[model samples]
Target chain A: MSIDKLSGLRVLCVEDDPDIRAIAELALGDVGGFDVKLCASGAEALSVVDDFQPELVLLDVMMPGMDGPETLRALRAYESLQSTPVIFMTARLQPDEIKEYLALGAIDVIPKPFDPMTLGEQIGGILDRHSGTTGYR
Target chain B: MSVNDVQASLVALRSKFSGRAREEILFLSRQAEKMSEGKLTGAELSEAYHVLHRLAGSAGTFGLPDLGEAARVLEKSLKPHVERLAATGVADDAIAPVEPLFLRGIEGLFGLVTDQPASVPDSQNKTVEGVDDDSHGTQVRILVCHQSADVRLSLVQGLARYGFQCLEVSLTSPDLAGVIAESSRVASVFVVGEQQLEGVASECRSQNVGGRQLPVLCLAGHDSFEKRYWAAEAGAEGFFSEPLDFPRLADSIERLVSERRYRLSGRVLIVEDDSDLAEHYRLVLESSGVEVRLVSDTRHLMQDLAEFQPDIVLMDVNLAGRSGITLARLIRFEPRWLSLPIIYLSSEDDPESQLVAMSEGADEFLSKPITDDYLVRSVLHRCHRARQLSELMNRDSLTGLLKHALVKQQVHKELASCRRLGYRSCVAMVDLDHFKQVNDTWGHGCGDRVIKALANLLKNRLRETDVIGRYGGEEFVVVLPGCDVGQAQSVIEGIGRSFSELLFFGNDEDSFSVTLSAGIAALNDFSDGDVALEAADQALYQRKSAGRNGVSVYTVPE
Candidate 1:
């Protein structure tokens, strides 16, 4: 189950909370096995995305200065990051939230307080399903 | 220590260390279990999920490790169920056993903490959702049922901020429409909630609120996708969801407000053959803040337009033996006003003819019996755009008055007709007494204000059509169309008095007004406007040497 699912997977995590970032990084790295980069806010994520060239972005829905949806919209316009897999992790998503997020080109939504052990595996499954037959190489 | 004091202190220690946490945990556990049983519906499950998420966060903050762990588990279990229900529209009854597991865990921690254990009732109790009696007073005439109280309050506050007199009621009531009907002047109804659409619709119909339609906005709840879809079908106007995207909601409100359109403040020149219809247009347009000037004959059309420089032209399509469209084409051919927005206010219902009229240079082709909103919208849409262009052409930068060319073209025909009728019209030439001395003493800014102040004084005192123009430099001219020599002198005398009394500019210790020397001359013997104007100038020169702050009338008798 040690899928290099995100090994050199180039994942960027835009979360405000250090604890949440620690939780996400630990979950994504320890479980998902991706090269996860963490930024504190949407603004920082926008600034640093050029240096990272992240293939998959785990974006927090609510963050100070720019927020998640605004960042995603700005990110969509960039030629380099247009095809990146974006998964929204939000504490506030009602059941109907998935459709709106998916419509905005998010690969999937991960509800918060995600299982630290299976975070990478779940993201790997989603990437695998979307990339089609890649099977988390 | 006394025996009673020792016992009380020990009890206090037990309560502080253990009892409160245990009681709180047990109370929450029982409440959670009861809600989770058969009592909570799919929608309530969504609410319970949100409540538990907050509880879990708080429990971690309070160091209630076991209670936090149980809350976390409950939150996790509810998420998938809510999501699955949203996707498949099916609720799994199998998740019922997970409720007891969480309750047992929280209760076990409660037993360890407190001396007095809080008892958990095993039997299920029914929880009624959205059935709380509205504690909000009847003063809240218009009830808004947003999912959260803060959002509803913010919207209410915003509306109140903009001077929209309204009321806000509680969201806990199931019968939202019934609460809305209680207002005497429910000028509009806005329902913004995601519950009981049928009940809301019936209440709207049963109220029989005439003319003013209640605007209904349903804010979609998590489990109410069908309600969001069928809400407007149930007679609601706007459908939104939480976090309640205010800009989108505001746009919808703007449309509703536009539907009940605002009064248009504009000027319209109506050209019609029928005197009654012309008068009717005048009354309608004037009541809606439109300064209307009607010309019943085609002969007076150019004069009216030149004088009024109206924002929009409302012409009757069928004029005296000619179509209004032909007249509009003729107007469009003029280089000075090639882009005038002419609207044909006609009874013709044919779309092809309407198109033909528009092609003939009419901006709008409005049908007769136009609604107040349609009329206001049409006039405002055309006029507001035209005003931007006219501002450049009409404005005089120096004195902030209408330009000489524009004002002359306006007052010329009025002067001609008034002269012909033996209406005892008078022309006065007013010169600011020693104006160069003023410019030299007070600088140009003060001089400008003095000139502006005099113009304002004359405009404020005299009738609107009594034409006053800056006849170059400190000299001004006023054409009194219906005034004889005696009346003109009195009018100019009053102006001279008011002009000398006005406060111009003050520099700390001193403030002073400007004075004017004017000469008045009636056009009794003279027939031409230019010759009458020249005679008035000679009289003004005599008044200047005869000492300033006085009026002199021109007379041939010597």
Candidate 2:
């Protein structure tokens, strides 16, 4: 089944920096009503991703251990996660980098220094677009 | 958790990290003291860099802005020594330039190390994500993840003199190895610390599987054969040892990263009625690794474009029974070809003709009589810029595949061509099976790796005439012109089988693979591009519903 919105989705938010991770949690979990499980590094995310059974993975491109792309590569190895969508959230999501993520099967890229208040909408919009739905972008 | 609860946790967390930050800063200061007193060596310097880098990255976050700035200064001072150490495996001897600045940074940092401030500094009140305080703005960024602050500083300062942007990340960054592999902005990485050297080097190697691998240079304690051999085993491009040579190391770094990034390879399309001139132009460019395709007939320009898809077009302003300006304008009318550069080559060196050519969508006008060297350079540079700009506009950043909208336009163009000319063309919609599971099981990064692996495999295996594009999510659309249903299926099936067999590692140990489903719609079976695309989509849906990881061709119902 295709998912279209951020609400009620179990998400794995992977980032290296503690501050950024906390903010992402607040934006995704508290503000957007997402079930967000935060990881401090790509390695930690990899260790917990299968058990978490997250519907979506929100990754920070430049994380510590496995990095976003590496983590995505690792996740693809598991048969159970081959269909799950991954969205990259990074400060360095420039045009070229976004292409890199898209090539890696990232649903979309959310630029860094995001507005916490509207992150839910941005994420939802991308997911909705991904699932071929339209409404509250 | 509530936003308020998370915010409160963040506040409390800041203080906790602040305590550790102060201790780390104090220890880093002690290393600086030793370096100042001339006790610097390869091993000792590497450790200091690690501490200082951690301080620089964390101090600003833990409520000590001034300390972070000072660490930045000190890191800059050590840049040259760091680059030299990692590139050659030797810690190059360095005369600290602007020693007062390093001393000043050390003094300022001591204030923070000795006493934890009650309030966070205003300058770093926000996340360091947008902080732009560094003066090295013009240099190409060269990141140094080292163990010694002094070593990184010397290396950075030396690199700064040679126009390199220096960024320092902590030794504990899990993705330190990947920074070069993932980020295009990072020209190279200088790693000095001994701990995790092998792991970091391996990560660098792993990230470089598809694209240009980031050059990883390790800083070693000695120039021993055993040490170099170990470094090579760990996937380091080169190891710079202590008591190193700075200039030569700098040159080596440039040769490895910057010089390679700037290497020229392009395909130029030459449209000149003069067969001799076109071959001459093609020959000149071919020598420099630039592929050249010539079109002597003006009428077949569009057909050639659809086939070759060259980086830049070299056209004569005057064509046999046609105007070059008219052709250029027609090319620009199509959305897919909007940025396709058309350089007018004309013997009519008149300003009026050049102005007219420019107005009608020509990029450059080379006068009738031009030297081979000038023509080659002009064509190379134009093609290079066109490719770069095209990547920014038409290509997706990650896989370097054509964008969704751009792909659709390409599909339409290929369909129109098939309709006009009696040639068979196939539109194949490809989707990766269980792609989302790849994201959930490993992470987005792995999912991306699978996607990229598939994309690269497709590009490598498929013919150049086949236009491939990422049509969002795990879906891709390929326009295989001049190929029938059977031919397209055979080609796609081979690609799908090869892709699944390709090994994708989950970690140090776990490796897996993925498969793709292809649905082919013969253009001749449909009325238009959209209908053909829909037929392909329906075919894809049928395959997905009936167990995926296979190809199904669409057949017109009687």
Candidate achieving the largest DockQ: 2
Q: Which tens-of-lDDT digit does each residue in A43-113 have in candidate 2?
A: 88778977899888888776556788999999888887898999987643347888889999998887654
Task: Name the lDDT of candidate 1.
Answer: 0.62
Worst 10 residues of 1 chain B by lDDT: B125-134
Candidate 2 per-residue lDDT over residues B1-558, each given as its tens digit: 654665565456556656666676667666666667766677777676666655655454444544564565466456556767888897644523323334555566654432322231122222122111121121244656667778777776554433344666566655554344323332454544455577666666665532445667777767888988888888777778764434335545655653354445788888888766675566456544477788877778888998889998988877778888889998887887887888898888789868977988988898978876687688778877886787778788766789999999888899889888877889999999988888998898878767766665555455555698999888999998877788688777866766665556666567677888989999877767888999999899988988999999987888
lDDT of 1 by residue, B68-104 (tens): 4455555665665688778877665644645554455
Model 1 misplaced stretches (Cα beyond 4 Å): A1-137, B1-310, B314-328, B334-339, B343-375, B384-392, B395-402, B406-415
Query: Candidate 1: lDDT of B488?
Result: 79
Alpha-carbon lDDT, every model: 0.62, 0.68
